[model samples]
Target: MKNVITISRQYGSGGREIGKKLADKLGIPFYDNELINLAAKESGFCASVFENAENKATNSLLYSIAMGMNAYGNQELGFTNLSLDDRIYLAQSDVIRKVAQKGPCVIVGRCADYVLKDTPGVINVFIWADIDFRIKRVMESDNLTEAKVIERIQKIDKGRANYYNYHSSEKWGRAENYHLSLRSDFIGIDSCADCIKSYIEYANNK
Candidate 1:
C-alpha cells in the first residue's frame, strides 16, 4: 500500500492488535508502544518518561506563552524555559514527524493523525466499542474483577480523551475528527481492518 493509515482508539478497543494485524497483512511496520522506544532513542530520554507523560497535557501557561514565541519566528525564549512535559512533547513530535517521513506504515495512538495531518496519502481511523463489549474485553484480557475492570476502563478512556482533546483542536473519538469510525463490537477486529482497507482503496480511487 502506498498510503499510510493511522489508528486512534479507545483503551480496550483492541486498536494495537488490529493495527499490527493490518500492517502485517500489508507488509508494513506497525507502531504502538514501539513509537516510545524510537522517541527515547531520538530524544535521548528514557522510554518510561514518554510512557508516564503519554496522553497528559502540560498545565504550564507560561510555557505555552513562551513556546508561542516560536510560532511567531521568535526562538529567543528557548526550551530551557519550558517544562519537562512540554520539552518531551516537542521531542515526541519531532520523532513522529521523522517516522512518518520514513515510509508508509500503521501508526497507533500518540495523536499521530494530527502530527501527520499534512502528509500525503494518509487515512485516519478511530476505533470504538460498546461499553459492555469493552468491559468484557478488558475483564478477559486483564483477568480483573468486574468492578476493577469497569473502573480501569473509565479512567483510561478519560485520560486518552483528555490527552487528545488537550493536544489537538478537535475533540477525541468524535466522528468529525476521523475519516472512518468503526465499532469493534459489530465489525470485529479483523473485519474492521478489512473495512478500513476497502475504504482506503475507495478513497484513493475516488
Candidate 2:
C-alpha cells in the first residue's frame, strides 16, 4: 500500500495549505473537509450533522476526570447505545481508514493521526505556530479584529484538542505522537511542506 500522511494542526497554522502542497508535490490526493462528504456518503448521515458534531467539543466531565490528563468524552456506551455524535465520530473514523487504504494521500485534521494510529506506512505530522503568528494569519484571511481572531484561535484549537483527546488514547499535537513536527510560522508554510516531502522521500527510501 502507498504511504499515508496525516496532519494534526493548530488553528490558523496553515496546515491545510501545507498538506495540499505536499500532496500536490507528491502527486497524491489530499483530504480536509472532504472527509465529511465522504463519511456522510459512507455512513448515510447528512454532511451538516458531521459538521456540527465536528465543531462542538465534548462536555463529558466524568470522562475527563476518569481519563486524568485531558478532557475526554464518555465511552460507557457501546456502539449500538452510543449517542449520535459518537456514532458520527466512528463513521468518520472508518472513512479516514478507508481512504488511507485506497492509496497515498495527505489528510488534514479531524483527528486522522489518531484514527490511523495502528495503520502501517502512515506518517503522522503535527503543524503549529507561535500564537502571534497564528493570530496575524487568521486576521489576513478572516477579516476579524485581532481580539476576535485570538478568541477564534483559542476556541477552535481547544475544541480540536478536546475532541482528539476525548476520542484518542494519545494527546493531540504531542510531539512524540507525531513522526514529524513542523513549526510553519518559523520555516514558512511552503518550506514546511517541502520539509515533509523530504522526510517522506527519506522514509520511503531508507
Candidate 3:
C-alpha cells in the first residue's frame, strides 16, 4: 500500500483497466490521462499540448541520459531552451514524480516506470497479451474490423515503444526493467490486478 505502481503496457492490452481496478481495490489514486491535466496546471502548458507531444515524431533530440530525476533536471538546464515536445515531456515527468512522492498511486503508461526508476517503494509492471487477444480487445473497444484493429494496435504499440525508448534508459517491455510482468491473455484482467496486489503484499512483507 505504500508503493507506487507504475504500469507499462502494450497497446490493446487491458493494462489501463487493470491499473484502475488495482487502484480501486487498494483505495489509492489512479493516474493515466489525469497526469496531463496535473502537468498542465503545474507547468502552464495546455493539456492538449502534452497529448499532442506523444504523437510528434522525434529523431534523437529528446533523448538524454535517462537517469530518472537528475537526468531530466540536467537536460539543457534552461527550460526555455528545450523544444516544446521535450518541455511537455519533462513537465509530465515532473508531475509523475511529484504524485509518486506524495503517496501510493497506480500510474498507467507514459514511461512512468523509467521516470521513477530510482525511487524506492516503487513497483514497475509491464502488461502484455498475445496478438489475437489484443486485436480482439481493440476491436471490441474501438468497434473496428479485425484488420483495422490490427493496424491500430501496431501503430499505437510502435508509438508507445518509441516514446518509452526515447525517454528511458531501459528498453520497453524488457522483463528485467520491471519488478513484475503479466500476460493479460492468460490471466484475466481482474485476476492480473489481484495477482499484482498479491505480489506487492508478499514482496513488501518480505
Candidate 4:
C-alpha cells in the first residue's frame, strides 16, 4: 500500500518547505499550489478562478443551496448552476482524490486530510507555531514589517480555518482532526520534517 501524507499548517510555519523536503527525502511528489494549476486544467476553469477560491470557504447560504441542488437535482443543471466558489471547490476536491489515487505523495493544505479521510495508509499532520515565531518568519521571508506580517498571517490563517471547517466536520488546527500535530517553532523546521519522516516510516511498517 502507498502512504500519503497531508499537511495542514499555520501561515509562515514552514509547512510547505518541510513538506517539499520530506517528499524529496521520501522520493515522492509534493503538491501545493501545483494542485491549483492541475485543477484548473482538469476542470476547464481559468487558473485565476482557482486562485481566487483557494483556501476560502463559500458562504453558508450558498453552500447549503449548492448541496441541496446537488442532492435533489441533476448535476448538469445543479452543479453547473452553482457559484464559482463552489464549483472550484468541487473541482479541487476531485483533483485531490485523483492525485491520491495515483500513489504516495505529500500534499500541503487544501484540506487534503478531509479529502482522503477514508483512504487507507493516509497520514495527516498539522503544523503550528507561536505568534512571535510566525511573525518573525513571515517578516524575514516576505520582507514585510512586523505589523504587516501579523496582518497577513491572521488573514491567511482565518481563511484556512474557515475553508477547512466549511468543508469538513472537524475543526481546523485541532489535534483531534489530524494524526500528528507539531509545533515547528519548538523543534525547528528540519526537525519537524525528521519527526514526520519517522512517523511515516513507523506508520508504513505497521
User: Residue-pair clashes per candidate, as listed?
Assistant: 0, 0, 0, 0
Q: What would you estimate as the lDDT of candidate 2?
A: 0.83
State each model's C-alpha RMSD to the native.
3.4, 3.5, 3.5, 2.8
What lDDT does the true structure give each of the candidates?
0.78, 0.83, 0.83, 0.83
TM-score for each model:
0.87, 0.89, 0.89, 0.89
Candidate 2 residues 15-72, lDDT tens each?
Answer: 9899999999999989988888999999899888888554467344543543344222
User: 1-206, model 4: which lDDT tens digit per residue?
Assistant: 54799999999998998899899989999998899999999999999877856444435455455544343233457575556666777889899899999999999998899989999888999999889999998898889999899878877887778777766757898899888999999989999989999998887787
lDDT for 72 (candidate 1):
22
Candidate 2 lands at a TM-score of 0.89
The reply for model 4, stretches above 4 Å from the true place, is 56-81
Q: Model 3 over residues 50-70: C-alpha lDDT tens digits?
A: 875553333333333222334
Give candidate 4's error at residue 4 in angstroms: 0.6
Which residue pairs clash within candidate 2? none
For model 3, state the Cα shift of residue 9 in Å.
Answer: 0.3
